[model samples]
Target: MPQRLFIDVHIVQTVPPANVNRDDQGNPKEAIYGGVRRSRVSSQAWKRATREHFDTTVPEHNRATRTRRLTSELAKRIVHDTKLEREKADRLAGALLTRLNLSQGKKASDTAYLLFYGNAQLDTVAALIAGQAHDLAALDDEKLAEAVKDLPVADAFSTGHPVGVALFGRMVADIPKLNVDASVQVAHALSTHETQLEFDYFTAVDDKTEKEETGAGMIGTIAFNSATLYRYATVGFAQLTDNLGGDTEAALDALDRFVDSFARSAPTGYQNAFAHRTRPSLIAVVVRDDQPVNLVTAFEEPVPSEAGIQATSVRRLAHEYAEASRAWGDSPLHAAATHTFTTDEPRSKETAEALTAAFGDRISFDELRSGLRERLSAVLEAQG
Candidate 1:
């Protein structure tokens, strides 16, 4: 029953945050994240990147699966169920999306009708309102689910299956496609590869412009100081596989393409970043231009001061992946890979250096990656 599955890869950026303050309503009145001054990258920007990655990576076997528009479908379903006229339904759907704070996308992202819980719909506030109920949250699971069903919404949401990100070949056990069980796995992939958390910080500041200074942490109070954050995250295939699934050759291929494109296409305003380009192209052949993938790696340039054992392990992983790719027509199953993340910046070693510090010299670099992948895969399988 293993359906041919495809992977869903996403990335989020947390950088160039602005400092500021917020009011009682939770709308940020300020911003603060990084120690110094930063720029603002709306949540829309990050989501746009994610959509771009999906759009560019759909392949021949998965052409039917690539979708960037779910908003319209949602609207259609709502109109049919709510007994509203076409225009009214459409407008209502849009307003609901806004009110619910859903589909917060950037101009660059594609978010027309994407919804979660499979086709599983949430308890419509409209339903609650109609039934003369005060709060929708008070309803139990059955009532909540029943409240949303019998409307125009399709029953095909989730097959009573868990939702999770699929990695490598897709399908969990005999179940084709990563499902509810795969949530942790998907989370693993997302978490390991460029994750981010956003928040606002505000405070008072003294300035020549006749502004007064105050603590940046104050909320609902006026302050001159502010900061905003878009925390960034990135983990290797080992880490992703540890939680989601294996990092199959196909996934790696996509990752390879992602690294190349990302290096060239980071938002110009956010350009000047050498981090994504930490390594040189290791793929023997060039991927066709039509394909798109999201690959972020830490390419560590071999250094003389490095530990000899770890360095060899790094090289060994590359060798194994290269060999498997040719012999088996794919990357080795369950193999771990690593890249030396090198840079001139003060925090260049933060990624690689941090690992060595945490794991100590006992484990080889290759083993480190392998361990992560296997562990993640096992954990996801269990959860599913």
Candidate 2:
């Protein structure tokens, strides 16, 4: 039973529509989940966030602090080599000051590039005489590989700098211990949609206990201000989790810790958006088996997720969604059904959603379409 990374990340928010937003090219936004509006946190946002928190995000976790440290040391070389005043050198590097934001002002120009090419001691004038600029990506991988053959590797056992980390994350090298096999198979894909359960609750505190449930309100049509979601992304210890060889538990622990931090802290710009703040919604450490198998967990002799060593991850998400629903007096933004996109060789859309339901007597395609048609007719009639 080899370890793998098998994950299914579902949206636990009530998806409100953007109702209307246009693409840069002025295309209508796709309405998902039966004519509902999409929120600012769209599928793309959720997917990106999920990947980032999953410890697989490339180039994102690079330390900004070090990128700054190197900026100054490199800038000095530029001025001394060119025999120019610091101001002129600054203009050449497009750096107002070494303290300027990495990408701000015209910084991130050729000075950083010069430093990268091991020209720290070499004067700017000499480097320019030998250096030429071109699209790095345009070169073939073999060619690029050949070009870097003589570049000195770093010292052994050194805790390398952030720039090195960034360089590796950027197509230079694979992220060490990252399960690239799973990532290549999945491409960091996740979609989110909300499913509403119309229920009548008699009003009672949940059994999680010790904590008080002040008010879990009834579901309504009001626009909820914010939501506290406890999202669970479960990947198995298998699916050939090789890139992370022997670090399955560590990876899972790190992922849970990362998500916990993310839940408590809102994205930078929107920290003040919500009135009532909630931490995590809830956190659960879901220790998984080497190979995850989906058995219909019918009332077999189960030991409460192995005496809580491997807690069931999803129960917390439900509690959080309920809490957000109650707190906001409305539904939170969530995605509904996700669909596949393809061209000529597309995945079969015919066997897509509503097919099973149609066959299982839950819903008929004709009936669903006819009902939608009738609604459209009613709108058209009113318009007429």
Candidate 3:
């Protein structure tokens, strides 16, 4: 059996009064954990934010598009690449999509569900259609299916996944062969301490109100809360390498981007009203040969924030990690951390010392990235 490898990331961040993620009722999401209500940011919200970050950081060719209008998008590509009439392109695209066993939506140009596809995969499909345009355009629906029965239409999406798709994965219920299991797992961020919901009540005055009019134009309330969050995520290095077609360099690059994006990306929910953008105060990455571990249990007994949440949270996390390492005897192959805390204050000094003692010496973010990549490269080579 091949060796298994995983990379685990732990973060401690503090967000001010903001609804970074909200439920249907338009309130900050929460969860009852450790027998108390804790501020929560769902994994879906963070994944969306991370994918958005990839739009700016990851290369265009290495990205995927998620939408229900796969037929329309592919039709446009067909028209562009083959210069076929819009009507002909639409028909051809729709027929090709049908071959994938994907159900159509109410409209012929839409798929029943959102399809996450890589740009390169779409290009391949478009090129395949262009090559067979003359024959495919002349055939009726029945004949077209027969002609493309053996064609590699489904194979286009079965591999060559973009980094985003590879990490997040895709599922096509109608065609089980199209499903790609996600290589990464993200945890819903939870506050390290108990939380209480708070609201802000305000009134907006009409700018053009008459001089005699004293009433406000609008009045309403918005729900929010502030907390020091503990965010966790893990990446299966073996699965990632396979998703990238066993390209170790690309796998390393993807891991590096995942780390950066997962750390820096913040959901834009109610961001304009709250401007709750803040960087993680501490980030720890551990590479292990065994299964991935989520240290969230460390906060099962909520940390008290009377002194300060961020510092206290950091200390508690360090202690939990130390105990886990000692109890499990599963010391990581490589461990490192990058923190923004300074040693000037006593609490901050204690937090820094604890982190250093738990996870080797503090290193710069760049150093952390390079070190992980180097270690991963060696592991991949050895496994090969």
TM per candidate: 0.28, 0.32, 0.95
- For residue 209, give model 2's deviation from the true position in Å: 55
lDDT for 76 (candidate 1): 58
Model 3 spans > 4 angstroms off? 132-135, 138-140
Per-residue lDDT of 42 in model 3: 96
* TM-score head-to-head 2 vs 3, winner: 3
lDDT of 1 at 204: 46
Off by over 4 Å in 1: 1-31, 34-36, 40-43, 58-153, 157-355, 359-371, 378-384
> Each model's C-alpha lDDT?
0.32, 0.29, 0.89
Model 3 C-alpha lDDT versus the unseen true structure: 0.89
Those runs of model 2 whose alpha carbons end farther than 4 Å from true positions after fitting are 5-31, 38-149, 153-253, 273-277, 280-384
Tens digits of per-residue lDDT for model 1 on 111-148?
43333332223223233233322233345545644554
| Model 2 C-alpha lDDT per residue in residues 1-384, reported as the tens digit of each score | 232333222222221211112234322233232233222333333333333443333343332121333445544555555455554444433322222222332454423321222222223222341232122223455554444344322221112222221212222122232112332111111112222222222444445544545554443231222211223343433432232343434334333333333333322222232233333212222222222222112111221323221112223233333354356563212112121211232333232322222112223323433333343234334434
- lDDT, residue 207, candidate 2: 56
Instruction: Judging by lDDT, tell me the better candidate of 2 and 3.
Output: 3
What C-alpha RMSD separates each model from the true structure? 15.6, 21.9, 1.7
Clashing pairs in 3: none
